[model samples]
Target: MNASSPIGIFDSGIGGLTVAHAVTRLLPNENIIYFGDTAHLPYGDKSSAAIQAYSIKICNVLLQQKCKVILIACNSASAAAYELVKEYVGSKAKVINVIDPVIDYIDHHYRGKTVGLIGTKQTVNSNIYRKKTDALGKDIVLKSLATPLLAPMIEEGFFNNNISESIIYQYLANEELSGIEALILGCTHYPLIKSQIDSFYKENITILDTSEIVAAALKKYLSQSSLLNNLNAYIRHFYVSDYTQSFERSTQIFFGEQIRLEHYPLWE
Candidate 1:
């Protein structure tokens, strides 16, 4: 593949759209192909081995599509399957995950702040955030809550419905997120619930979106590798293990603008 080839990105589900959108905004001239494994959404409950298998499958599919670089846009998959994909990508392609960049961003920007994390059970248990933040020499007081329901709520097209709002409200009610100066939306899928998060963060706490940090990291990698694509070209292709209207609704929620999306199957 040439340097001008499009980058491939994938997530367990619609969560990856956040990363894809961020990369597009930063590198508008480059083309992107995104895959969402909606057939097996909410990877939190699945075993690590299962997630790794799925991640490897997605990487192979993306490579066959002629992608020069791959982004494991899902946090769960990144924690579980990044090494597997890295082997396949080798020197020919680079693989970027969404975690390390945000950790670096928070370490540099908000030193010694109380950082609260909300993600899947697996992500919280992985402690990648805690380890990375501590490595930057900042004493970060990290409190994590396993927001298992948020993914399904958003996936089912219930952003503002009774269940979605209730789940979010319940998580915040008894829990003491008060000392947290900033909250990290640890899961990519959580961005769709941004409105509720913003409205609830009226107590002067800052909510840092991981997508921004991921985009900046992606730019740095492209520049360092001399793979920055700038040509008279622009295109984006979307794929899903199973696509549904609910996926479109979730995309619209995160993108801030509706996109004409074409669905492709990855299981073939």
Candidate 2:
């Protein structure tokens, strides 16, 4: 409710750090508290109920930290648990999701255009992008494919090499994603391999930057709501429900630098 309160951002794992990084770069003065539910990594495979439960638990932790806003930075969690989180956090803090800002951008810029989307199985299967685009009545056609391997690959630091390139190429070459004017990186983790994806496309097609879009949206909301932090000095805290050496190492890749991560097990 106040300008000095930190923004809360949560993902199923390190993938959401992409969004966290973007927010930090865009709004350096705002404090941030990030939670990675590593105990339940890849919400993509979980049922809607499970995602909802984890999201609410994370939201409660963020709210306890007095976060002015809570951002669901994972596409799978956003698709499955956004409404529930929003409703649960009402009056306490604002709740935003990664999907809506991209959808709004598409509505404004890509009307009547064929757009391709790549995400985890849950995000793709949830049909969130297709459904929302259809509701726009804009004649926009959305093609989606589930690239289940990309997140785990990126988390394990497998990108920017031959193995990563081959997998990226194979996914992009899928007929389901062909003939699209733009591709939405539905998963936050996709941005890490964005250069490879651009290389595969030869920069011929537009690759939507979901992190920037979501960050900009957050900025707009904060500005309008009088919650934009103005102080130069700020603090950041990173938490993971479970810890692993790989997750610790991958933080640098997603967050753009080395940062400490505190383990805060929700079930305990």
Candidate 3:
């Protein structure tokens, strides 16, 4: 639990880079080691068991890197594997998930109102948001929509263009999203299009994205635990199970810098 230890963050793919970027901005002195399971990506469509297996593999790599804390930056992975990772990591490192922070944000800010949730099929089908909201006794109506296309579309570089807009409109304009005061961008990849989604709704509804929320949560935890890094030189390492030009492109897009990404193939 030393301050110099890097924070580990992982997602199914480059989507988790959103959280990694936010963490860097909020805690500039903390080193980070991010792993993207690009080979088994789009975990949203996969079964819970499969997601857990992938998550365990990623966490093991993160632990081997000597990370002091682990952040599950993908919604689908968080939904399926947060508890498992938490249990597995135990006291060796803290485990944070993108899902709980957003849920807590909604519970505190949007209580008694209708909140819309959008994520991949596995996440929505898991009914995690509704279950968590209910467990917290938050008196809000939780409406969930399985948006299985946005991640792949964004991965293919369709973001912020006419094609992206058309797909976003088709999903957000659905009847199921009506009457909600706030919409939860359940996927980490969704923040890349946060402005588009906001514009589509004309800023009438609040869009909750996990990047800032999770970053803030991590900062608070680090501060309270006295684990804040004091060094000025921060190192960031990026790894992917499978390497591709598209992932490198998306990493730069989300991280806002051309970073050298390393390949660490987990499956043979």
Q: Which parts of model 1 are misplaced by more than 4 Å?
A: 174-176, 256-268
Candidate 1, residue 115: Cα displacement in angstroms equals 0.7
Top candidate on TM-score is 2
Per-residue lDDT of 137-227 in model 3, one digit per residue for the tens?
Answer: 7688999899999999987778999999998999998999999999999999999999999999999998987899999999999999999
Q: Rank the candidates by TM-score, best first.
A: 2, 3, 1
lDDT for predicted candidate 2 compared with the true structure = 0.94
Relative to the true structure, candidate 1 reaches a TM of 0.91
Q: lDDT of all the models against the reference?
A: 0.82, 0.94, 0.91
Model 3 clashing residue pairs (backbone) = none
Worst 10 residues of 2 by lDDT: 245-254
Indicate the residue-level lDDT of 42 in model 2.
81
What TM-score fits each model? Answer: 0.91, 0.99, 0.98
Candidate 2 residue-wise lDDT, 98-190, digit = tens: 999999999999999999999999999999999999999999999999999998888778999999999999999999998999999999999
